[model samples]
Target: MSSGLIDTKPLAGIALASAGYACFSMQDALVKWMIATYEVPQILFMRSLVIVVISGVLMRVRHHPSILKSPYRGTVVLRAALMLIAWLLYYNAARSLGLAELTTLYFSAPIITVFLSILVLKEAVGAGRWIACIGGFAGVVIAANPSHSPHLIPAAMCLVAGFCWAWSTILIRLVSRSESTLTQMFATSLLFGLACAVSFPWIWRTPDAEGWMLMIGLGLIATLGQFLLYEGFRYAPASALAPVEYTGLIWAFAYGYAIWAEIPAWNVFLGALLIVASSMVLVLWERRSEISARNRAAA
Candidate 1:
């Protein structure tokens, strides 16, 4: 991700992404719970409406009554649309796919983001960062323990979802440069609500009291998740934070085990080690880069 220009606070960005991903993993869990009872559009419409109301109020209070018309308004809208597509593909696939399998396929997003960062954002990705990305995905594959005979269609959908998410990550970096966090967030939520509202009437199954709780809970979690993630792109380059997305796998497995009593295998331990090491590598790399820049400035 680039705000047209990437500043080099990789460590901070990584931290924010790490925290943000934990929230995302939780969001996925919440969606998985309601997918059986609710259509994607219904869930998204409700969730987005919550975010819109919350962010809109905060936007007015924090800034002004007027929406800050970003020059990247088009890009912001595109990002929001991409995320909606991602949720649709991902949640639909979740109906047929196991959690581990679904996440394994979607984990491809980081590598895609890294490549896209180099290609789209024109960021100088170091060999270390590439190694970190590879190592982290290797960890995810090990930890995921994807089924051997996963349905091809759902698997493909997961990959497409990952790609959509990767594209949105780039957009976050670009838009964050010009748009305030609240403005971009409000814009995204508003668009998401409107788009999902289209089919919401047709698919509407009135959420019962329990359903209402879960949906509102989903919206709150998503609001925090989106905020932290968008703020992350501000602190670090998209390429730099890409590997940190792998940390979500750690949270994902944790949630699975906690919720479903899925015991961890040997591979989980092995994979977690690699993922942690890969993060360390990125940290060291960023540290070195920062020092070098300082030295160059002094010289």
Candidate 2:
């Protein structure tokens, strides 16, 4: 019974992580569609308004009125700031880059997260995991193919966004150890909303009806994705949930091809395969190590 419970939690976490990635991919697609007609700041401002409302409702539902009362306010605020910058870079890149390519590049966040975990949390990574990280990075390089002349700027933006995302993920992992998920959500919405508002004066644009709907949808979807993502961490270790995030690549491919008629180059698929394989290997290694430790404890 205990073992069943143990297995269930991580499985649930993986499911949530996969679902979160899907939601995020959908949100990205919406952002890409809208960015063609609107500025990034306008989208950010409108979407952030939606997130603030949704997050507030979520906090109320959880009976946590004091959403800002987190022990790790500084860390949470910093994380939100990193995410805001990452979002700006990613949305800008999405304006020109194919979705599949941008996603593959951004998925490099997992590799960056692993290294950040070591540096920030002082977590020890085994040699095998280190090798897996290298493999994943190599895949990113292959997928990105900096040698490609025209994509240089967008690719650089994606890399920088991925690095910022990695830092944000590490902060989320750290803060989640002691902070409430609702608090985290609230902080993100509040801080990011404020940031967007400050930029709104400079880049404000009136949206059409269709644009408003898309902006609202983007915010709501992103809020749900953020909730599921943080909840996944609550249920499972970061190592266990990390690989499930690769599912976003599948969604990205579908959305790219269907919506924009954008098909990635062959090397993109090859690199994506490597990234996914390395991530899976890391997940399996962590699961095995966890089970082994549990068995040793029982013995």
Candidate 1 — which pairs collide? 1-238
Error at 224, model 2, angstroms: 1.7
Model 2, range 1-299, lDDT digits (tens) per residue? 01011322555666777789889989878887887788887777777777778777766776763634656778888998999989999888876786446766787887777777778877666765776667766776666565534388888998899999888877877787776676678778788878877876677888889888899888889888988888777666554555566667667766888888978788878877887887677667766776787899899
The ten-residue window of minimal lDDT in model 1 covers 1-10
TM-score for every candidate vs. truth?
0.94, 0.83
What is the RMSD of candidate 1? 2.4
Instruction: Quickly count the clashes in candidate 1.
Output: 1
lDDT of each: 0.86, 0.74
TM-score of predicted structure 2? 0.83
Tens digit per residue, CA lDDT, model 1, 217-280: 9899989988888888888888889999998888877887888787788988889889999999
